[model samples]
Target: MTQFNEDWKSDRIGSALRGENPLVITEMSSGFAVMGDTQFLPGYCVFLPKKTVESLEALPMPERTAYLSDASLVGEAVLRATGAKRINYSIYGNTDAFLHTHIFPRYHSEPPERISRPVWDYPAEHWKSNDDSYKEEQHGLLRDKIATALTQLMEEAYLEKDV
Candidate 1:
């Protein structure tokens, strides 16, 4: 079992910035797109701002807009990569006090009761148990899929803007 530094839980963005976190899928203009540690729901990801900010509103307007756009791009990628029925976008800084977004891919394969509930409603062990975490191989494939999807979407958006 790989042991993570205790600081990682308190400074996820910092860990990613320092190259200590292996979850990073790709870096965006405003933030980094990282795969969630757990794989209970495949393609789960988080968007973390490159600069530390207590809340979303703390960012400059342009930065905030860029972060939001990045979150949407991540959601689109997760949707495509996972074949999810829909993606859930959430921003709650109560815990970490950092400006970040969680992008969850909701699937048709989920139980009927869970399909309509928030991802948080799932078993706590799903997030808390290290045993449930994704292996490096799995993480790499998922990261590639999401990164590829995001790249395609970005290119399409740029082409549209140019036209």
Candidate 2:
């Protein structure tokens, strides 16, 4: 149902592709990697497919492979940039109704009990926009670090595979 309109007004993927999304770090082979709105977990990000597809099954085998591979690249870059203990990857079309992947960085410093829980369970404060929200002025450096790491990883990966 989601479509990429030219104005990039309602579509994040469209905004990202047009170089209008300030949160976009860089464009990967399969899609665009944009910074997340919340920094509750630093280095959180999302990987969006290049095209407007409702689900993973909508993509052909090659595109699907590229999307998955690029998702992993984003996770690794986040890990390298934020020193996260591990990464969490999730893709569900329920909320957004589009093809995208969420890359969450799990830190060792997280509350012990909540560390193992899904990010959605981290309380409302983490998800709501407030004083501690993503501002380019504050989080730009971290975004750049992740972008640099991701670019390097992509180069090495695609080069090795000759893709």
Candidate 3:
């Protein structure tokens, strides 16, 4: 048996804060937009708070709002980049004990039963299975697509603000 560096999963927020994680797509108003390690869903991502708060309620009201807004922006980016039929937003911190929002891109091409169910219901193999892991080239392409979408959206928001 091999022991992998699960450290990335353990302290994703810390890694992002340190600028040590290549998975970070961009720094948003309230958090960092990071690509998911597993590419099963293609454009999956997470919005991680800059500070390590246990939950959204732990943040100031304004910060909480910003985090939510950032999560929404991530979902929009995933949708635009992947052409996903829908996006799933979730924020359960049972395992990681950190404040983060999962932005999952749901596709119409997904198996019918899996499409309508919670993403957690998908087989474990799809979650982090070595066989289904992302190749280097796939990671670059997906990251670029999401980053481009996020940049465009941010530009649009700025223009609107200036209008």
**In terms of TM-score, which candidate is strongest?**
2
Query: Which residue runs does candidate 3 get wrong by more than 4 Å?
Result: 1-8
RMSD of 1: 2.3
- Give all TM-scores, in the order shown: 0.89, 0.92, 0.90
Count: clashes, candidate 3: 0
Worst 10 residues of 2 by lDDT: 1-10
**lDDT by residue for model 1 (1-163), tens:** 2556667767888888887776788777788898887888988899999998999999999988888987898899999988999999999988877788999999999999999999999999999887768677657677788999998987786677689
Candidate 2 lDDT over residue span 1-163, tens digit each: 1332336537888888777776778898899998887888888998999998999999999999999999999999999999999999999989899998999999999999999899989889888866557677788899989989998999999899975
lDDT of 2: 0.88
Residue-wise C-alpha lDDT for candidate 3, range 7-118, written one tens digit per residue: 7666788878877666789998788999887888898888999999999999999899878877888899999989999999999999878888888999989999999899
TM for candidate 2 is: 0.92
Candidate 2, position 62, lDDT? 97
lDDT comparing candidate 3 with the true structure? 0.85
